[model samples]
Target: MANNSDIKRRDFVKTAGAVGAAAAAAARIQGAPAIQKVKAANNQVQYGMIGTGGRGQYLLRHLNSIDGGRCLAVCDIYRPNLEAAIKTSKDKPKGYLDYRELLARTDIDAVLIAVPLYLHFPITRDALLAGKHVFCEKSLVFKPEEVHALRALASSRPKQVLQVGLQRRYSKFYQTAKQMIEKGMLGNVTHVYAQWHRNPGWRMRQSPDPKRQREWNWRLFREFSGGLTAELASHQIDVATWMFGAEPEFVVGVGSLDTMKDGRDVYDNIQLIFNYPGGRKLMYSAISTNKHLSLFQGTRTEFGEVIMGTEGTIEITVGTDDEPAIGLWFYEPGPPKVEKAAGVKEKPVIAGATLATTGRGQIGLPILFERDLVTGKESFLARELKYARLWLYKRGIMVPEEDRNPVDVELDEFFQCCRTGARPKADLQVGLADSTAVILSNLAMDEGRRVYFSEIEKMGRTPEAKGRKA
Candidate 1:
């Protein structure tokens, strides 16, 4: 119930004081060892990009910033995107209207694909067949059949790496969170809540005909996109899957076009709960109604996750896609209970300070409640179990490295996988799992009933092939 200003003030104080605690978290993450340089090893990763639209261009800029990779070719149906990529990369390596032409470059180390969700499977498969590694974005495939096909393709080409653009998988904060989960820091984490609220859907480019313009937008149509599912909820769904260490067994949700009634066929709002194995569940919601956020640190409007457990809860966000993926952890398990017999003071102990008065004002960005940083190396798993209780006694906040970009990290990771045969964290299976969740959740919402994950499985490897479309 804190106002935005009040949230800001409270957060500023914590961040101002958390500088040391943040360092402790970082040092522990690096094993207090000398930072080894993991830059794309050989720099010989020559790459071409397909679907040179907004997303392609976004990655193009990042690819340029990376030290070793070179953009060898640009492909897009539209002239503008290809031209823009050409300009940004400053490499007149080659240009093609058809992606196949770009794929023909024998020297190209790999292909960076950023296309419509519908086309992910074909382009990625073709890229792999072309004997080039692939760095494709998620939802990996539009339908379920692509899932099995790509998995098979990847297996056949085990020598080459096929990575998806689910950058959070490469994030350090999330990496830390996953380690914490494995170590039982949250103590029986059983439920999670994730959301992404935006004011409006994608804006279409102006065109001669309005219908053509809509078609060009692609994201607003079922044929080209999965509405809020593939376009938005995919990330959080992956987060839930990753954090929980398992896929959901069942899902139920509701989708409505109540918010952005702009004549688009896809729903503008959706709410879903995924029941994972072992009684764990994920509560998710995405709406294009407002930009108001309820995310990490309880301070900023953001795209983040809250992992709830028995001993404590951690609220975190993926840091910039670049060198540092920042995340914060808060150890607030639940509300304080009342014991009337003997009146005693209940206060939050964080870092080394007792935060009794809510710090007067707002919570700021990059806020870390100091008490959260425990010696992660003491006994990796055992210490986290004990620290979860102690951390609930406090919290820790982390910030992004100056100018570090997630897009850059994703691009670099893709390139490295392409060049050195390194398997990426977000591989084909990971992306498909996320896409499958999107497809099934939408089905559950549309059918107005709970849907079993088995239903999706029974459909087929490629859900689309089985006639279950997203």
Candidate 2:
């Protein structure tokens, strides 16, 4: 059904995609060594999980696949969650009501803290004091003081592995995107747009015991959570910061408790703009009314980021269980070049004329993975099969997937870091910066003004402010 020219064009595009994928793979390999899996039981990093709530159980599900870490205990005040966590662990870990009791165990070489935002600091501090490595979920600290305190404490214990649960750092697709940025594929990136939208987001679950309702729905309260900013936006903010290679100078935002008024103090919808250095900006939005995502041709929803630049744009999002992480590259057309007379200097073209000649919107190309890279080491049949798969991917017949989930990869890396005494990719500083963004963004919304990032140095430092909430 296809003409020879059409087949040749398809082959050319496929080959080009393959080359780009190989370059990305090579770049990532150059940045860091390949993750080595530990199979020996004697080398397993003994760890304890604190929290065992929904997030804790989710991590446990991923941890079950990683053999480098052995969960020795799980702690939670709620009996059901503790039991659920114990059941989830392949190691049949001991259950504890008090996280400190679990931290007290000399056998626990590391602690994975998945408690609510408020408890993250206290538990992490305790775990560090107990001489156990810690992997805490993000929006790493609750308040500004905790940010400084945790940084100081983690610095004091440099030998211990302190990783934040910002899993995009471990994602291959994200790594490739970063590599692309570094390689000048996306020239002079100046703006990023990100969103995590949901229709009727985060409903309050009724507890059998009415007294425990507030405690259970911690995310809905200002006391226990930073709301959507910490829970959702923190992740994307980290992505923007990572891409930009710097933190924002100032943040301005508006938030409202508009729709879901079930006694929750946190906002149901928020829109924010983070002004980074060099005139760059990250515009963000998280709404509860709509789940539409403008990324990936709207094939997906809920969350994604768009990085815009002079030469190209990247639309990306980390994958979930049902979907593979996707990164799409759209190349921007440069202004048409005018030929000058021989040995004559040419004047700059007018902006209006240049704008008219600049080309139309481009069809996006898939930012390929290592699997898509053709190293030319494969057998004849292997090469053919790889080509077939690439064709299928380009035709939307199939999607390219990461060899492992980023969540699983991050957890595995945490355990590996624990064993090797290596610094995690999402180290203490990265977590602290993310937390600072959360604190300032909330402050910006609460005060209804642009909040400068530098104010964090003096904030929560005074003795009087220690007792007060920011």
Best by TM-score: 2
Off by over 4 Å in 2: 1-40, 338-359, 374-388, 463-470
* Candidate no. 1 TM-score: 0.75
Which 10 consecutive residues of model 1 have the lowest summed lDDT?
1-10
**For residues 171-247, what per-residue lDDT tens digits would candidate 1 score against the true structure?**
55676678877887678889998888777656545754454666576788787788888877899899999988899
* TM per candidate: 0.75, 0.85
lDDT of 1 at 443: 88
For candidate 1, the per-residue lDDT at 387 reads 59
- lDDT of residue 230 for candidate 1: 89
TM-score quality measure for candidate 2: 0.85
- Report the C-alpha lDDT of model 2 over 1-470, residue by residue, as the tens digit: 11212122224235434543553365457642122233336799888898788899999998998878888898776777888998999999988876656765666788898988887876777667666788999989998888887887778667888999999999998999999999999999999999999999999989756866886788999988999999999999999999999999999999999999898999999999999999899999999999998778778999999999999999999999888899889888787787778999777877679667555776678888766777899899888998998888777777777889999989989988877888899999999999999999999999999999999987878765545434
- On lDDT, the leading prediction is 2
Residue 236 of model 1, lDDT score: 86
Each prediction's number of clashing residue pairs: 25, 0
